[model samples]
Target chain A: MGKQGNYSFTGHIRPRQIRAGALRLRATFCLGGFSFLAFIVLTITGVLLLFYYQPGDRAFASLSEINSVLPYGGFLRSLHFWAGQLMVISVFLHMVRVVWSRAYRPLRELNWITGVVLFGLTVILDYSGYLLRGGQESGAAATVGQALFTSLPGGKALATVFFGQPSPLNGSTLNMFVWHVFILAGAVGFLQMFHFWRIRRGGGVRPL
Target chain B: MDLIESERPQVPVEVEQSGSQEKLPLIELQVREYIGTFLWLGLLFALTAGLKVPLDSSPKAAAISISKAPWVFGAIQWLLQRWPAWLSGWVLPLLSMSVLLTLPWWGRKVGKTWAWIIFLILSLVWVGLTFVYWSESIN
Candidate 1:
């Protein structure tokens, strides 16, 4: 009964499951571990990045300050960058692996869809994180994004767009950060609920 | 009229592991087989922990497209970008529904492997275009 296929870490875990040793756990945890690690890094560095990064025209100056004056700002920034990219890559591989395994078959379909939605929200939230920097890159990207959004029927309502209009970058970029942290934050939390619910319904990620 | 003494299931490849012939209880499923699912997803979450996306300071507009959502919605997004969202939403969902409905029926008559192959081929092409021709939209 100590099979490696149908795995479940929830509830009273069996001794045999952990018996696989560090190598298996390490290999298996690489993806899940990275996700947990990146989230921690984001919280820490995101706060640090905020200290020097005030939204508006002064943002570029903040970037310079972080890059120049702030202690290990460059390192922190790089860590944030690396973590975000790594999270995206890991999430994709995770989904693909789930599909090929036919884990979504029958009763688990809801979770698969939930995972898909969660994945999309992650990309959106993560995206807004980089965009809020309001640096030259962030500013330019916002302008283009505004254009793309404005192309939609009611895109101007987004407040992130404008054609030769005063892009919100002239105002406060913290709003973008707030949107990323708050709006999308709630959505991601809901997704986790669905994931757990599905797992419970399907009786731990084991096969049918 | 003894031309054909066929005493075999027409669809040899579609293995129905259910009822008596079921592969037995306490089925085991491996997560390792789902490497793509975990790795990419884990990386995304990991990146949240201060992992850098590693972009140049210049912040090229083109780079945005490279920052993608997931492949699950890539086809939908690709179609949305090319066509109207209404058409993309309604038609795509309908088509998918039709395909799923016919899948079991088709697999029973014509091998399951054949059906899987078709789906696999389609996924490969779509997935290929996703990584290859992906628009560099950062969002």
Candidate 2:
């Protein structure tokens, strides 16, 4: 017996005890692990980006300087961008894998639901990041986003709550910066921990 | 496989003992996670090192007429081009999410079918929109 002999950890099992097809890479694609990795990468790169980023009208200019002037700043920005995109892709794939494997049955449903919410957060995180860039693309996205928000039921109030007033010199970009840097990211992290806890309670990965 | 039987997890020891069942410490999983993450980071750096982070001029003076949303929002952007903003922007995404949230309660076949159908439709729309945007740019 190894030192880990029946250690009774919450979310693990002996590697040998997996089902016939369970050990195959296709079963899960290790997406959950990859998504977590992407999040961590994003966090580190995002923090690095903060030093160079100035929200609002100067946001675009700040990004330009970061890409052109700062040491390895472009690299950090690129890493953050790629990590966010990777997180979105992996999280979506993770959900698909879960559904495909029928892993949402019975006691596992809560985790599935949490996963869905996480997907939404991940998208928003990506969107907010783009908006922080304050490029033409981001400006258009913000306009559309505001339109979408206002078009929904109670959307006017919801938009106000989320986006604040859209003044020419308004703090919307700064608001988005806060969300991208802290609130949304923190929420996703918290939800992810809860998600993992739920999975643990439901018993690790479901056998394929 | 019976739903009831499938719901009960198959213990590894009872299932297959092809000498694959090396019960290592949970730390092994953590180690694997770190290695996988590092490799992914290395690949990401290698791939993106030469590629610049795109910042198109600036929004300080650009006209919104030719502006576009990120690729992920391409589907909604297309729908916005074709349909009412509220419908495409608010209703479509919300409806899809609603369906997704409630999917687990549906019967297995029905749930899976709906999921696949929704995923396929949305993905096709997104891809099609990307093509449309690209073609428009080229022209």
Candidate 3:
């Protein structure tokens, strides 16, 4: 999208590029590409969903209104939900594929570890998404999650940072909303960029 | 030493032939990737369009027993069923992730072997837990 002379992001795909190739495009199920696509869909749908969603005590009621009253809101919500689910599945399969191919050897070891952390973050991303819906199930999840968080070291304080201190039911839901839409999403996006840059630096997903 | 005799004349290659390397433009590659991404998005949109987002009934006073963790946590939840939350939820998850992060240092052979072992055990545990949870739920 920049000046052809500069060739910033597009530089990775050039023929003289000693690092990567079309073979990477040809091989395997293209899980990494599919995962990125899923993430894009999730982001777009999530942003759209944000416009209609209200946090806190009215969250559940607001969601119900989005489902019933807003035009295409239900479809948008479903797309966001399914895209998040797809990202989780694709990212996992992608990891398994990399390990199976023995592509994480030697210089690629750090990328592998980064991948593991990315996987954990993806799981948290989905978990926090559920928390955003603010239904009975989500409320129950928060309760159990809070219990789990409180059980760890300095857990009380850490839990406050992560999920906020318990307040009225709505109060906690608002906190969860902030974490889900902003905090966790931002972290995952940043880490994924690192993950890809590392992949390129480490020689682009192994030959064939 | 006969250094003059050993030094053979170097042959010059044709510049045109040397320049004829088969490298595609980066834009071509971007187009291909974009096509695949759009196709995936189209299929995903169609799938999502047909399905409605589910909203469970509102919270009630007696919602605890029915409350289950998300499906991804089903396996970990089962561990919690059999052990303390600190052990199953916190300690085990942390241990497994840390082990995974440090796995590649074991060298390719040992690392691969251990990775498979860990993966298999986790998969088996998850399957077993899902089965148990299913049976318990149905009954």
Off by over 4 Å in 2: A1-23, A165-172, A205-208, B1-24, B62-64, B109-139
Task: Write the residue-wise lDDT of candidate 3 on A1-208 in tens digits.
Answer: 4486336333432333322333355444677778877887888888887887887677778888888899977887888888888888888888777777656676677778878888888888888887777666776677778889888777877777777643323223667778888888888788777777666544353221
Query: Which lDDT values do the candidates have, in the order given?
Result: 0.51, 0.70, 0.69
- Per-model TM-score on C-alpha atoms: 0.56, 0.81, 0.81
lDDT for model 2, on a 0 to 1 scale?
Answer: 0.70
Candidate 2 clashing pairs, residues 3+ apart or interchain: A16-B21, A17-B12
TM-score of candidate 3 chain B vs. the reference:
0.62
C-alpha lDDT (0 to 100) for residue B117 of candidate 2:
69
Question: Which portions of model 1 miss their true places by more than 4 Å?
Answer: A1-33, A159-172, A205-208, B1-139
Q: Which is superior by TM-score, 1 or 2? A: 2
lDDT of 1 at A61: 62
Q: In candidate 2 chain A, where is summed lDDT lowest over 10 consecutive residues?
A: A11-20
For the second chain, the TM-scores of the candidates in order are 0.43, 0.66, 0.62
Model 2 Cα lDDT, one tens digit per residue, A12-49: 42232333243346757778878887898888888888
TM-score of chain A of each: 0.72, 0.83, 0.85
Native-to-model Cα distance after best TM-score fit, residue A55 in candidate 3, in Å: 1.4
What is the per-residue lDDT of model 1 for residues B29-130, given as tens digits with 9 covering 90 to 100?
A: 234425544564465445544444333243322333322333334555566667875565446545654554344454555665665665466557656656
Between the candidate structures 1 and 3, which one is better when assessed by TM-score?
Answer: 3
